[model samples]
Target chain A: MMHRIDAEALAYSYTSGQRVLDDVSTHVATGEVTGIIGPNGAGKSTLLQLLCGLLSPESGNVLLNKSPLEQYTDRERARLVAYMPQSVSPAFSLTVREVVALGRFPHLGPFGSLGTPDHEIVQDCLGQTETSHLATRDFLSLSGGERQRVLLASVLAQEPQLLLLDEPTSSLDLPHEAAFFRQLRTLSGRGLGIVVVTHDINMAAQFCDRLVLLGKDHRLVNQGGPSEVLQADILTDAYGSPLLVGEHPQTGGPFVTAPVGGI
Target chain B: MTLGNTRFLLLLGLVSCAVIFTCSIFIGTETLDLGQAWRELRSLTPLSEAPTLSILLMQRIPRTLAAFLAGGGLAVAGCAFQALLRNPLATPYTLGVASAGALGAWVAFLLADVTAAIPLLALLTSKQVMAFLFAGLDVFLVYLLAARRIHTSPAVLLLAGVTLGMLANAGIMFSRYLARPDRLVNMDRWLMGGVDVLGYQPVLLLAVGVIPCAAVLLLQAARYDQFAFGTTLAAGRGVNIGRLQTTTFFVGSLITAVIVSEVGPIGFVGLIIPHGVRLLTGPSHRLLMPLSIVAGGAFLCACDIVARRILPGETPIGIITTMVGGPVFLYLLVRRRFSDWNV
Candidate 1:
């Protein structure tokens, strides 16, 4: 494979003796969108952090491009994997352009100024993320959806082969959510591997090429195409509540909904 | 700002600072003619012949320079503290530099009283050395407390600093109670903060301390800009957060100690100047740092003029800064919150 990330039987626990993840294993290849879906506290966020090397695995290891993640320098690893965490409020009102330019830090040498080519790449990212018009606008003044797009543009500016997003659409409304996933699909088609931690099962089923469902005990319940993983029995077990699973009326993919009655 | 415009603004800022510096020397308590002063300055003449020259060289020049250095140094430290702590309310004094330095100075006074014969122990009596040591101790304590957390928040660090300051203030009070009543006058004078100048010695000492620290801070201006985003985001952008925070904390506090050693604790210049500069030049430290330094220096020098000349008597320079800066900063903060400027 051109680019692949693998985690082998990984585990982690916080200092308070609460286990966040246990013996989890997964692999994501380039040109695919992998959706990680589970109920709250299933260690979905923790797993994503481990995969991106933001948090080291406690008992196992993560391999990026066939090399142990710990072996790569921060600069080299950043160029290979760009991570966009949950939404953050900036301490100062930096312009969107200034915020996006920060993504070039890993690429630029010490005391290096942005050159013409770097500017072109930044502009390209802004355009792709549809934030070109907001370049001069203050980042703090933007709407939640717009802020997500600008921050995503910052991640894209790194030009990583793999993109890791945690709850990227958590703050987005319906239209923005759909548009964001469509953009992710477009990026995946363009040969960038995307791994997203999301709670919306219907959207995950609709967009993801593969889905990894984590159960309440922080172990993988199932991993397959969305059609196979989004079964009613598995959804109920993973979420600890009754869920209605059926075919999408328009897209012919698995669609999930919460049952009106109790579990 | 666009590149060309920012360059122009920076150049304009430097020129204005130069004009202010020159005018401050001439327009002090004794107004000396500029031409004669320039001739004397250029000639390097002996101080005994020209009375204006003697006062200018012996007193006003060094005093003005000290005011500028301390003001600029404090402002730069303030900007670094605000950025490093990610809090607008944070200043160089937030980490207890003033209180700790005061405590250290008190201890020095006590030691000087008890051990008048020992030369090495006598060295402890220098307010500068005592203040520096206590300031260093404060920083070390804060670092020790905050570094234990995996992701130390600004609030945590600020809390640690405030607690340390309160403790140091308590120590100073105890020392004052134990010492002779006559020595209380010296302690009180040091606490009031003045740009008292004898010759270039104090100015030289401040320069040797402030310049290198300010240079180190200026080099990190772009990184400071990145830190405006929260720490985690900045780290994802390739900044080594731990190293940046530690270096900035020590250097910023070092400059504060250097200034406090020279002129006690000059209140509000550090807090006021950075906020004012942000309004004028925006929050990018690359522009903000140099401008803050120059503007802070000029601001203090002008304030010292009012203290020496316009005030009824010899008012301490720190008093004038608080009197002027407190209201101006309050007005700016209120207006900024309502205006397009980000809080």
Candidate 2:
């Protein structure tokens, strides 16, 4: 019943005077996988940043646990929300375990070293993300899919109540993308709120409990369960083209197919 | 890159440092008379009775201490610079702080000669103080320009440092032209980098300045590891990036400044030690930073011994480091595949 993160009428503009998000209000609830789905440049990433308090909105407020997000210290916010950006590649030859251990920084003191329990959590997270075998390997040598999973394990080690990911599957192959979403679905069942920005409408429909569609103008156009919001006309208008909405043959969930020619 | 075998390597390094440091004190121009030195060391004889003790106290001890300080300070500063810039080639010298410090010392030399009575000239004549002042100025200028333009991008900071260094070098040339011909050789000698001082003051000063900076750097080992993941990920992991950048830049420059002011820019130690240690210890700063400091200090101390004994006359320490560092750097480069630069 409690909201993990609530953004009220958030707006943001770059220094070049170009607005990214305009009057966008959204909230992420516990134990649900919420997907922000839209075409390119819909400000989904910006909205996620605002929710994580990485960027302050030009107007409106983001609250965490009923307190203004800005009031929490950087370490406190990091402990509450785990965010994984779109790209993470090691510039040095750090081992995979070292990379995942970074997620425990917010919980560590200035001179504190990792103790037994911390190692246990790191191992558990690595196993949950299917990366336990790669713990001793060099992070720089991992394949793209493996790298993303390792990064996900790192974020999971933060042990936050809210998890935010930005285009995590943008570079992944089809099978890996499906596997990643399945992992997220499994994670959401454990009662953590998950918000992911994705362009794959079908995956959003199949795995996400709710979807918020953003238009090109950087406004939230519609929000609801997959069957209620994935209407043909709404998606066509949102994407600026003709789209077909259908049901998955077996699961009966919503599916999307862009038409070859506009009607 | 793993610490599993590094404990053995670290133990070997520490023993070598101790052996070199002790052997250096005994093998000066005149071999320390062991019987007399032992008596003096045990306090069985007074200073006037034991000439070997005077030689050891007045010359060998301070010189060894200076060499150790210069080597350790530069290497730790090198590690910090490389991590902050995310570039292994980013040594403290790359930032132009050394050149500016040298220019400051050059100006002080000229002023001390032109006027013998002024109290201000008396202070500047120390040369070390003057070098620190100028290094501070260079660091300030680089940070100011970077913050105003690119908000402290590592690439921008590197460019700014190189430009400022070139300007300071030009100032050095102009000062040299105005300097009396007799003082020109003195300028050249200072730049050559020697640790032949005869008193305890400089050694004490260097130790007091370098140890705290090294401690601060060691404390940030975890943060440096996060920085290897890129700034965005570092911040996501709760690192205060702005504060980390400022603290590292300030402390690294200060360490380099104090060492350069004391012994001039001992070239290549900064660049070589970190790379060498990284090869053995991997990239975790927790093990990399402190090990580099110890290895660098021992390395330079050993080089000084070679400089003192290899030829009839002593060669400058900088020349020795370059001669050694150049080949090692080449080996590292030749061994590395282009894929190592993938990140």
**Residue runs of model 2 more than 4 Å from their true location after superposition:** A1-3, B1-4, B40-50, B108-164, B330-343
CA lDDT, candidate 2, residue B321:
88
Where does candidate 1 stray beyond 4 Å? Answer: B33-52, B113-133, B136-167, B332-343
lDDT of candidate 2 at residue B201, scale 0 to 100: 90
Fraction of native contacts under 8 Å reproduced by each candidate: 0.40, 0.51
Poorest 10 consecutive residues by lDDT, candidate 1 chain A: A104-113
Which ten-residue region of model 1 chain B has the weakest summed lDDT?
B334-343
The DockQ-derived docking category for candidate 2 is: medium
DockQ of each: 0.43, 0.53
Instruction: Please state the error at residue A76 of candidate 2 in Å.
Output: 2.1
- Per-residue CA lDDT of model 2 for A1-263, tens digit only, reads 44588889999998898998999887897799999988888899999889998888999999999899989888898888988999875667667898899888888877637888999999999999999999999888899999999999999999988999999999999999999999999999988889999999999998999998998888888998999889998888788778899889879988999777656
Q: What is the TM-score of chain B in candidate 2?
A: 0.86
Candidate 2, A127: how far from true, in Å? 1.3
